[model samples]
Target: MLVPSCENDGGDSKIDIQYGAVINIQKSSSSDTYINLVALQNGGDINLGFTIDKAVGDITSMDVVGLYIKSDGTTIFKGKFSTGIKTFPYTLNINKQKIYDAFTQLNSSDDFETGDQLTISAELTLKDGTVLKLINDDGSNNFSSNIASSSTYKVFQAYNVSCPSELGGTYEFTTTNVKAPTGESAPGPLTGTVTFEDQGGGIYNISDASFGGWTGLYGSGNIARNVQLKDICNKISYFGVDQYDEVFTFSNLVVNGNKISFHWENDYGEYGDTTLKRTDGSNWPALTL
Candidate 1:
């Protein structure tokens, strides 16, 4: 009888793994994440500091650039920074003059406005001449899931341009017109007291966006309370959805003295025109659509 026997063979399989460098951000270095236009005009600067993680790869040097992302999805290359970095930990002190100069180089006549964003990204060069970037040219991430999930590994930093806003207070709301979903005219001439609570960053929470018009037509429980107003550089706009999951749009907005009058219509054919007057005798800022 022939017995089949198995012999152990020394065979092995190996996998090669590559690791990239990471930018460990120190969030405590930057106080605010948005650029205050008022402060920038007053000679303020954007401060950001980070360190390269040498534990992953042999990173020799890093080059960083600034990008201006407009509100209309337009991206412009601002300029590169003179980091003068010779060590792992680096601090970037970007002054307002540098930003202004970069913007002027692109468009001398245009100025930085609200609703714009500024992003700083970097490219790391390895000792073997391999360059690694965490952000793509189109402002997208190029890191893997594991790297993206790391809290300290930051690819880029962005700051939004905004103006100081203080439009929150008590107001007298007067409804001039109201229309139901059936296109039939509803009861108008509604008046009430509303409150605009400041939520910071140019956002205000209205007590009732419809200003008692929806309550008069649909009752108190059905009135819209989830409406918000955004004031970016005095440009007023609507935010959030109503109780019925309908989005609202404002039109014919006029600001005169201490009064703000506008016409609002929802996606479901509900519309109302209301005038809000400040009850505290404070003059409202010049607001536009």
Candidate 2:
């Protein structure tokens, strides 16, 4: 009789799962999430919006905070952006005046330099006196891997300080002393016209990276057309692969008024020194590196 009483019940066993709250980024004014230095200097605002998901929790209120992270990795607590916010969705209009005030409160003498970042996060208070937040006191994330990996569960947003790029136009490209793979002179000085088409956010689509040297060495059909240039806060660099899947390296970058000159080499042992001058009679903004 005791052994017969060990029969299973008809009801199914279940495990209940509860999820914590999350901050979902709804929209951003800048697609690249950058705070334009030129616009900030001209009295513009940093605009973004987010929504709080309750996620099976009883949330009473939330406090939004900001942290200013310098380029050297120093983190400064800029203090709360909003306290006791009971709203589900909120829009942030961060102006230069508010940023300046925060810096002043911290007694920091540093300006809002390029490459610095401003991160926004929040602290949520539940009905049972429980506080939940993504960031810790030491300016580090304290959340689960599942929440961190969720694209829709964005707990924080970082906006970088960037300079406005205006380096898109037609340029007269000149290449000299191009060398082949065997270290032999493949071509003499070659001159041509190239276009710097703006692709936004300091990126430009160059008409050609070889500056007619590839056409001189190979045929016109083998010219590098997929080459791209990046001007990050005046630092110039090359990226993107050529048709042969070879990467390009750049050096000796010098910017003089309306002219930009640099030395470039590819993985195939081909190299050249090139100079580019704007044909619109407009001087390029001061650049370095």
Task: Please report the candidate that would top TM-score against the real structure.
Answer: 1
Off by over 4 Å in 2: 1-33, 40-43, 48-160, 182-184, 243-245
> Can you write out model 2's per-residue Cα lDDT over 124-205, one digit (the tens) per residue?
8877776877576567876665565575567777666777778888788889878888755655578888887876556688
Q: Which segments of model 1 are wrong by more than 4 Å?
A: 1-34, 46-69, 74-111, 117-160, 183-185
Task: Give the clashing pairs for model 1.
Answer: none
Q: Give each model a TM-score.
A: 0.57, 0.52
Whole-model Cα lDDT of every candidate shown, in order: 0.70, 0.70
Candidate 1 lDDT by residue in tens digits, 1-289: 1112334456654444455666654434445545676765665554444333333556688776677777776666556674434477666555566676655554321456687777776777777876876577676766665565466466677666778788888888889678888765656788888888986557788888888877777666556777888877888888778666789899998888988789999898888899988867788888889
Q: Report the Cα lDDT for residue 160, model 1.
A: 61
